[model samples]
Target: MAYVGAATALGLFAPRAWAQEGAPAAAGAVDGDPKAFGPERHGLSAFGELQYPADFPHFDYVNPAAPKGGTFSQVPPNRSLNQSFTTFNTLNAYILKGDGAQGMDLVFDTLMARADDEPDALYGLIAKSVAVSGDGLAYRFRLRPEARFHDGSRLTADDVKWSLETLKARGHPLIAQSIHDLERVDIESEDVVTLRLSPKRTRDLPLTLAALPIFSKAYYSAKPFDASTLEPPLGSGPYKVGRFEQGRFIEFERVADYWAKDLAVNVGRSNFDRQRFEFFRDRDVGFEAFKARAYLFREEFTSRTWATGYDFPGVRENKVVRETLPDLTPSGGQGWFFNLRRKKFQDPKIREALNLAFDFEWMNRNLMFGAYKRTVSVFQGAPEMMAMGAAQGPELALLEPFRDKLPDSVFGEPPVPPVSDGSGQDRNLLRQAQRLLREAGYAPKDGRAVNAAGEPLTIEFLEFDPGLDPHVSKFIAGLKIIGVEASIRMVDAAQYQQRMNAFDYDVVSQRMSMSSTPGEGLRQVYSSESAAVQGSQNLSGIAYPAVDAMVEAILSAKSREELNVACRALDRVLRSLNFWVPAWYKDSHTLAYWDAFSHPAQKPRYTRGAPEFWWWDAEKADKAGVKA
Candidate 1:
């Protein structure tokens, strides 16, 4: 209840669906000096010398002039972009813990970024500098004098106050739940905005405050918040929404007379003349269009088309340029999800058995065409990933208390014992599965698993969106080998959402995109309270106490050590639960683009997924004869 209450206070009313998520370009050969593209690049003109802060970490960077007009096509999910009034909270970007539906962050601006890697931090945007009170209850934001919204209205303390107060009152329950104390937004003068909160809410204030998306009171007051109408969404950033077509694409035009055009933070970005997003319903169709030169670039792989079906002579002659970026992007977890709400899968043993039945080695090589990497824990191959510390000595000490809550072997070395295949077609894993099912009150008869009272144990592999339908179908074939009767039923986007919200799924396959913060991720995935709630991210429908405690501790952790300790404990408990069947990770990005484009020699790190940091070179683009 404490978890739910706090989440509500911060306007986090609903679990976020999957959404478009970015990459940076490495400073390579350019027409200008490489250092010219540092964070300070935008603040200086073409002739000015580059500047860097003393404390700023050195990053592989690039700087290019805003390229001429060109259109970038992307595949968008079928969902309503306008969520403010459609049973979804629009103002709760920060409080919601998952990758939200489309257009949340793209349309709005947050007070601060979730991490330092991304540029959303308002160092020179709206707030010049920020200071947190010693007790953490009070936060002071020093507003930049030149900050103004798209409508040319100067951003003031009232706008910030109104945005926060309005969200606290009318925002989602999750948003308002975390924020307590009816403290006032004290205007400490024209340039200073001080937010004072009660002591009870200061514990996790930074995480919550980091989510606040300060809106212009002037723009919103003129017209009510309505999803049906795409009135120019007010923003204090360098880009503003110019045009939007329902279920299509939204175009953002640069603010020509923008206040922060020369701001230090605004430099080196918004370099495109017009950022136009083209939406496609399917990825394959989009890829074909990319091959036909309809779009700027496409992430291609050695699938049926790339391996054998490249009939286009031009593309064949000038083969798609391939490059490998080393250890820069976050290799996200992509796999099938076991919905624990189904009584058939409520037993952890059954879930574990399902995980052991398939071989990732064969699947990646044959089915996936060697495009994926095997993942053990949810956070695999990530730096300081929780899985890295699972059975490590000191990390085990943190998890020792939950030995009873988890499998005994989990706290000991090697975590959960690996399941072995039984010999003679009745492998050790099959025997173990039979044992576990019997313990869960299942009986086997005539090569079929039956539940209590002679009902055949049937599990349906559900797919709502057709985007993942084929992959789900391929997985169901694997399940059949293990004597599980599995099938796929693809629903349209609307129906898929309805069924998902009702918790009407058996074994659903989904790719859960994670954030940089493990605390935020742990809450969304394994919390007991979140498991039961409709639209909750705990899609597994698991309710475990030890996992819950670790999640809370991780959320409230102050330093890196506390975070590491809590993460290891939570990982052990979650793996023992076995609610999720480990799947594959996309190791390499298979992008195919027209010959007209030249990319940066060095690839920028992708803390986010991919796409945000890619820039267009008008010179190379024109030389290649590509058009908008």
Candidate 2:
């Protein structure tokens, strides 16, 4: 799944920002300093030099001469319950109340666009160049002269400053949290904007600010910035909002004279002449629509369906192509996260007991058709960032200060999730779980585990997707074997979002996607400060000081080696906590598309280009009997 935008990260408007209070600036000054950095450059990388230098013609992942005059259609990609919108109520995706339309980010351009091949490098888009202060507290962006909004107005520094201020004040909670350290926005000229950050912020502050989607301030003069509305706002991007029905479908038409069309960063991207998203209430109906050619492309996520359900005429006649593309980035962490705020789950022994009862081997073999591997670390998909057998070297040194506060096991080897012996009932694992539960004050009473007060140890697993029933049922059955009263409570999408924002569920299945280059976003997920926030991503309610310190170490890392050590330390500590029952992840993406669409012989190392870099072939569609 794609990294969810700031707006969708926080489910609702709580109007809270992260506090900026920490150490002072290291050293250096503005003009009189000899150590100050040079003038603005073309790109920025997190910890190293950029791969593509300035004046480069195009990215290595794209086909520079790829044509762009055919329509591309597909169902909107679903990341999670809150991230994916079933029915869009507003075109303004920055706000909090409404379900924003998918692909709305395509209507606006950020100061910098992330390179697909690299981990955390960003190439300039609207901004021609950017420079950082010697003290690393300020970032200045020089906008391109030819940048223009859909309304034909030039994009200036004032608009960029206004966009930052507006999003900080009235946007979603996650957006507000991200830019909370914005001390000020100084406009040096009509086309140059300087953003000053607080001394407490991380090195990633400038990059995150550069990635903000810039909107037009003049267009919103007559409209309220915080209110949810369907009126399309003016933006300076490759595509503009076109035809749309309220909730069924939305189309974006490519701008024929898009200003950045010839830029090095956008040479072979946004190839589709028209991009459309067709809405369906469920994935089953959407798959049927794809088979009928209602949409030109579809990404299959179900293992059962991918293995057995592709025997239709489209595949038999070679009209549809199925391909499994490898994902190079970290899959992040997906698992059954416990609500630590709940008193019942506060005991570490109980949490560990719950983790031990999950039968991953049996489930993978029988239900998933041996299509998945057990996820061992929070950063399992990325080898460099993941903590392996044991904590040693720099990683061990980083965790030394907090040794007394962490588990002793963290110093030896990272804990892997309990493995089952292929049978659904693993008596050895179940016995161990029972022993842990008993030690944690849970005892067998009337065939159910009960505490001292005669209250049964019951857990409710909240779910938004009905398709997860079979998968969740297996885990529920395992818990029952250990004398726990576990039940599944499936709710609608809206209710699920409401419950999630309020942190009302005892446990929920969630997938937290991490970037190849980790940064301050880690704080939002595991920091103590975010634990009490209404809509923060600290779903596990994690509040350990050790975890917070490790997050700081990661954010303040100055080199690639430092960052790796910090990530390993953090992963080791989190695994020891046993806050989540680790789930399964597939390394490859299962995609099924009509033969009409064609892509470059080489794919991006970090992402599936889909309709963005892939183009339509008229001759191929004609031969495949597909109506484009």
Best by lDDT: 2
Off by over 4 Å in 1: 1-60, 64-69, 76-104, 113-124, 168-184, 197-204, 226-229, 300-311, 317-321, 327-332, 388-394, 414-431, 481-483, 595-601, 608-611
How far in Å is the alpha carbon of 375 misplaced in model 2?
0.5
Alpha carbon lDDT of each predicted model: 0.51, 0.79
Total clashes in model 2, counting residue pairs 3 or more apart in sequence or in different chains? 0
Task: Give the per-residue lDDT digits (tens) of candidate 1, residues 326-440.
Answer: 5443343446678877777877777776676655555555555655566556555454655543376656766667776677756654343343332213355556666766666
Per-residue lDDT, model 2, residue 385, is 81
Candidate 2 on 1-628: residue-level lDDT in tens?
Answer: 1111122232111111111222122122447672464466788777546789788999998988888888899877653223444567677777656667888878999888888787777888999987766666677788998989988999999889999999889876667777788889999999899888888876666777788889888988888988878888788899999999977899999999998899999998899889999887676777788889888887776787788889999999999999988877677787889999999999999999898788988888878788888888878787888887778888888899999988898998788888889798899999999999999999988889999999999999997666667777988898998899999997866677678778999998876766766776777778898898776788999999999999888877777677788999999899999999888787777889888888988888877788778988888989898766
Reference-based TM-score, model 1? 0.79
What TM-score would candidate 2 get against the native? 0.94
Q: Candidate 2, which ten residues in sequence have the lowest lDDT sum?
A: 10-19
Clashing residue pairs in all predictions, respectively, total: 27, 0
Clashing residue pairs in candidate 2 (N, C-alpha, C atoms within 3 angstroms): none
